[model samples]
Target: MTLFFAIVALAFAAVIFMQQPKFGKMPTGDRLERIKRSPNYKNGAFQNLSPTPSFTDGANFFTVMREFFFGGDPRIKPTDTIPHVETDLRNLPIDEQVLIWFGHSSYFMQVDGKRILVDPVLSGGASPLSFTTRSFAGTDAYAVSDLPPIDYLFITHDHWDHLDHETLKKLRSTVKAVICPLGVGAHLEYWDYDPAIIHEEDWNQTIALDDHFMAYTTPARHFSGRGFRRNQTLWTSYVLQTPSMRIFIGGDSGYDSHFAEIGRTFGGFDLAILENGQYNKSWRHIHTMPDEVLRAAADLKAKNVFPVHSSKFPLATHAWDEPLIKIVQAAEKTDLRLLTPMIGQVVHLDDSTQVFSHWWEGVN
Candidate 1:
């Protein structure tokens, strides 16, 4: 009965594979009930600000998969090691507010004496399996040990790239509190994080972080999921208002009217950190193209903009350097100030005269 033995072995393998902790548990009980009450939830999932599709017209999943595997450009990833600056984060002056990016969407900030970490996928890869979606050379500069105890950890959604299970597991003791969109707490809770320290909110909801800091959860035209299912959790952008600065932490959004609405509601932002990479024409509705990033900055009326979501993983078919090159070109057409800091380099939050070198140049 060789065939019978093979079937039994296959079933056992499938069961073991499904038991990995990274798959995470879904929301239930009160959490599910609360999610059901959200105004944006419909048809058993969360909805975007506008009707959105995972793929553009005429681009189906199989066709896109074929292109990704067989027909994409070879230079989509860099051939040389990326250049970066390594600044010791813990010793930075607390009085001086600054930002230090750790490539991709991970960054650390100190604004008005509060330390903030956002969407940190710092475990060197963005996928559940360590081999896939690995960070580019020299981009995995920061580990969990590199960070000081964080005051607030903000998670925009439950996507593997953003809500990394390995990274979060290591950060359990260091994170003071977590702020994420609705239903994302289930994953954190499943990973042994304290439920009391995790705060979940719906869009348009506001939370007072302390006497001097407040955060407003805003809408982003994106979807969220970590597994076969999608959009079961709300995706969000955020407005961080401190005593002296107002920053827009745009998690990940496609081009939409929500940016202008947010600007009007909050009277504009001092700094806007927007997504500007991992985009494909086939899935343009969930991620911003380079030109759309500039338009989004204009729509937000951001006095200064830092375009991130590039220079880390080769998530799309474009060359790793393309997002930066296109964004620089688009920025020249507008008067808006652009911040392009190297990974781990310090960015002064209040210094208007500060300038960063174009480090992306001369790199292969």
Candidate 2:
């Protein structure tokens, strides 16, 4: 009887803990109304283009939880600090076209005379609590202070790793515009962002960022939600057409027909930044598997593929370096160029011929 009470009390306390600001509020009032009108929203939540199961065949909730929490690959994290190169991004010439990856799914781009940041989770961790899902060492190369005043801040979704409350709060002052998928602006508004700066759009919609740049909200086969009530918001990829280059920001998705569809629509891209790590067989329907990365890149007809979503947080049970090793091997057999720069290395956007060292080779 006493144990039962203790369990209930602990569960109740956890519920209270989740109410804190970092968890963020769901869309309410007008925001909910707008979300309801989205073609992607249905059955009281957002739906993927394809019917994506939460887990693959032979994988159930209990088995997945057991493997993920207690058993899986032994090398969940690297032995040494993850390698990196730090640069003062703001000091770069305004006209210089460049991109810097801050590990995992976060990156900064200075292209076409605009400074853009995507999924900037530089708070040293990817969870509401700092200790849980802490970033790999040496990957916390930049704080919000290090960024230049951002011309555009692009959030792919509202997952804690991608849409960190602490990081977003710090960036609010400098960010000129906030562009995100449908229903994500609710969190930004809860965090006190100016609603006028937030532009939320559904899939297949395009917003012109001034006369030279057009931003298209595209599809990905993934579901979204921060709390237990899932799919309250949309997950998305983006196609950015600048004056001289076209870029694809693949927020997160599983392998599906959408890749070919996007390629057909956009024709091709100069660069496609896709998710390529923290994947497992259990949740294969949502995140891309190892071999699928290269295949997806090929389907997109991208000139160069920069794989992110790894080497930062141990969000899956695969060996820390498996994504890079496997992707590189697959890439060797194909003509497509795979960009695998170290955590903070500068990728010169104009230099398509620029070579990135296999930085993951020596690190344990």
Best by lDDT: 1
Off by over 4 Å in 1: 1-15
Give candidate 1's whole-model lDDT.
0.91
Worst 10 residues of 2 by lDDT: 122-131
lDDT of 2 at 20: 94
Error of 1 at 137 (Å): 1.1
lDDT string for model 1 (1-364, tens) is 9999999999888768867998787889999999999999999999997989889968999989998888777878888999989898989888988999999888999988889999998888898777899999999888999999999999998887888888999999999989999999998999999999988999999898889788999999999887768888999999999999999999989999999999899988999999999899999999999999989899999999999999999888888888988999889889989999999999998998999888888788
TM-score of 1: 0.96
Off by over 4 Å in 2: 1-4
- Each prediction's number of clashing residue pairs: 0, 0
Least well predicted 10-residue stretch by lDDT in candidate 1: 14-23
Clashing pairs in 2: none
Model 2, position 273, has a per-residue lDDT of 93
